[model samples]
Target: MFALLPLRRLLICCLSLLALAGCDRPSAIALDQQVYIWQRQWRAAHAQALVASHADFSTLRVLVAQAHPNEGWIQARIDNDLLRQDGRPLIAVIRLDGQLPRLDSSAIDQHIQTTVRNWQASGLNLRGVEIDHDCANNRLSAYAQLLHTVRAELPAGLTLSITALPAWLSSKALPTVLQEVDSSVLQVHAVSRPEAGLFDAQLALRWANAYGAVSSKPFHLALPAYGVALTENGDVESEAPLPQGGSRRELHAKPEDVAKLLRDMQAAPVPHLTGLIWFRLPLAGDRRAWPLVTLQAVLHQQPLRSNLQVTVQQQGELFELRLVNSGNLSAALPTLIRNDAAHCESGDGVQGYRLQRAANTLEFVRQSPGQLAAGQSRALGWLRCSQLDHGGFRVSP
Candidate 1:
């Protein structure tokens, strides 16, 4: 018994040390949330979109300029009045064409300096400038030198940042490149080939861990809030149509997947991870982007639920069918909508559905998959029936 006393004391001391270490582990902190408004053209709807997202996002990263090899520099026609009215910290983003064999460093520096001066002169609250150039990993050293020059050219009070790619993880010059900027944004979405799809949560998590391991400065993760269409000709389209004739596959970033990623990051908390910057603020009637309601819910970590209801509005012998989503999440359009009616003169499906007529029944079959955003309604079809049973409508999702 006397001999076992020292061993028991040693075991207790080790356990106590382990418990203290566990307790000392850092708790996850609330990260700052920002958004990107990448629209090249300023429209009336952009004002409303900015207002809708103003409460959730603390900073706005706006695409102010783009440099192309052939087209040279094109400045975005932003609505300065609307941006002034919105009253949020703005980060002007300058995108350089990645295909350029070499950069015009002096021209880039001049553009940056001029844009900052012009934006500030317009009474816009410009806080930072971000350079978005997806240069190859091997070109990182040259990219770093460009960043260093740009950083020096920026106004004294403004911060400088860069949009980084996961491919740079293998480059030894990554540290040197990072050293030139005040911050970096790791864009994990849409980095892979279109065949691999838009996003992979597990792979993104691994990249985040690896980034955190290497980056000494705070970095933000640029997540996708929208999607794109991949054409058979190996072309990706967003907000435009390709002239090529072929079938296209639409890929979307699921809100649930992003929410789960946020939760996972919060639980584990990557070192030097500062915040999340969602790509492209959603505007009303923007088909490719997630609805503002759904995006807001995901940002706040709210539970997602979508309730789609098929309702009928009648006027004498004419009946109109509509689908409404009352829940907070976006719902998929129903594959089938069945209704029973007797002696129907004419019936037609209006939107993305096809009308099928059978004895004593009218069926509206979806022609293609679509989403009905939360709090939105769409007209399915109309029917002119002598005797229409309003209660005989069935919806299959």
Candidate 2:
């Protein structure tokens, strides 16, 4: 008994160290980054945008079909040539109307099959299909059946995924629904009503952990990279011009908030959390989406900053004032701009700024709130001053 005491103590110590090692083990899953190109129409700019963003995103999830409330089914006109040239792994997404009375499983399956065949015929590197449906919790079981049937209909090489909602976390059928699909994407952004705003980082983190607990298979979190304008009549406009009628409120997800969330998630990763999928890739002229540089910086865990400068160009007596954002982050337009110029003949502001000229100072007052995307320039106004000091311009936020 005396000889066994030291051995037992050594055994206990080894067990304690093993338990600590188990507790400190890193997650086995590596995060795969992806982006969604949700544009309905593909243009030259879209092609260029895809080329620019091809390296950052591992997979491209393109919108293939959308079910409208009254227009029935609308198919997206994808740029096959561009997609083939890019040669990235593709996952076609089909959005279903949540308010639909019933599911047309057969028709949907046929559509999915036809789409896959056509894309493959076009030489696209198609790898999978993702169904984006935000149905009620009670309907999850039915949704699961639909997914199961769809999975059976897809080709052997193709995988199946679904866009999940946080609301379904409470449902007992969530596990069953998750089991039907090969993987899932938990959309935490814009899941609430319009009044609730676009994104809540804390709430999103909580939802993600909860979803990780429920989903057995690997899953991704769909985060926002764009803003939406909500109209007084309850109309939401994303990547489109708001109709000229009622008042509108713009809701945007701050980059800093999202970066903080990403850091926290990296520090303590949720279970089975595979990666993040940014919603809607940013195009050159996309006013609502974050600039590509800003998005890239956030994804790469770089610092975020915006350097706004007022530059004046002179062609003889005519001077053009412009606002230039040279930093990696988008910046809010300055509320005021003052320039010291004497003998100003005439000056007028353009693009929502009003010019006020005093004895020796030119003041440009902001008429509305706006954002200046990174690496972009906007013409504030032009000035015609005989003795203008271009170096004496000041910008006030």
Candidate 3:
């Protein structure tokens, strides 16, 4: 390179130019700094933070209440004084549904009655007891009986509440239901459904309104601090949300996944989230698949991926099993997967598919088709059994 100007000459030229421009070196530097500040700091300071997506549940108490023969009643009150001391309304959960590990309904009733009495005795007014269930079911009648016995024998200050199912919204399904429960909590967690239609928030509103009018009672909602991710095997992947929904998408969590399910008679709405209860509290923190308890976003594991991809087509007793391998990896069908429309899937991979011999047993496919790729699905199985289930019984044990 040839030298265009010496260092001393260049420096002299700049100084001469600055003098003609009538601006000091520091003034020019200040102007450049102002430009930088406007481009960075000013924009940053003015950027809007996101608003919360979940219903304002600051006054909620997500109680994890449990009872047993000798284990004694576990209350968020005595167990966690911070919650009790704060006077947050309690959403006492009493496990009234599902297979019980020695869950005596009589014992459970006695415990609830005694607990409510004791709370009244202690001058602690409880809002409600969340009776968890897939639906009101025959359980509601039994619960109503238990509640009547309890209310008749208790102090006047206490109240009883239970979870509601959105399916109750249908007039035809509302007959054998509870007539006098105080309030109902609609779980926005997993609707008692196995499909995608039950996550609509609008359906939730109608369901809640219907039940509220039918019972002539105010309905409260229990919003989930998380969402569920299901795999092709029909297993839940993650289950909790974080403290706040992230990003600016505002695709925030809604409280009606239960109502969106037309089957849930008890769906809660955003305006009346009632006493926000986070279903059950995790003994451990969040899983990699789930989120923290109250984060707004759906606690997603990997994008908006679904884990349900089984294809079943039945043709009388002799049916073929065809499964579409929508998952990332290839898997052998241990049993012929059945659905309402089809008995088993056919093709894609069905040379040697398996089938269930007993209620819970998987046997080798009488026929043999081989390895299937991702996105490819097929099943091959036969059922001469007396009766096949509507939800498609698993061919594999």
The candidate maximizing lDDT is: 2
lDDT of 2: 0.90
- Model 1 lDDT on a 0 to 1 scale: 0.90
| Cα error of candidate 1 at position 287, Å | 1.0
Candidate 3 or 1, higher TM-score: 1
- In order, the Cα lDDT scores of the candidates are 0.90, 0.90, 0.43
Model 3: how far is 108 from its true place, Å?
1.5
* Top-TM-score candidate index: 2
Badly placed stretches (over 4 Å) of model 3 are 1-59, 66-78, 99-104, 117-125, 135-139, 171-178, 195-198, 237-397
Better of 1 and 2 by lDDT: 2
Cand. 1 TM to true fold: 0.88
Candidate 3 structure quality by residue, lDDT tens digits, 1-397: 8769988999999999988887542221100000000010112211211012123233333434554335555553343333344444554456543444334556666777766666555555366555554534444455556555644554465466666776656544343345556665655435655455324555555555665566555455544433344455454444333344323211213322422322232222333333334332322232321122222222211222222244545566544444455543334444444333232232222356544333343343435434443334444444443344534434442
Q: Taking the tens digit of each residue's C-alpha lDDT, what string does model 2 give over 69-168?
A: 7888999988899989999999999999898888899989988999999999999999999999988999999999999899998999999999999999
In terms of TM-score, how similar is model 3 to the real structure? 0.43
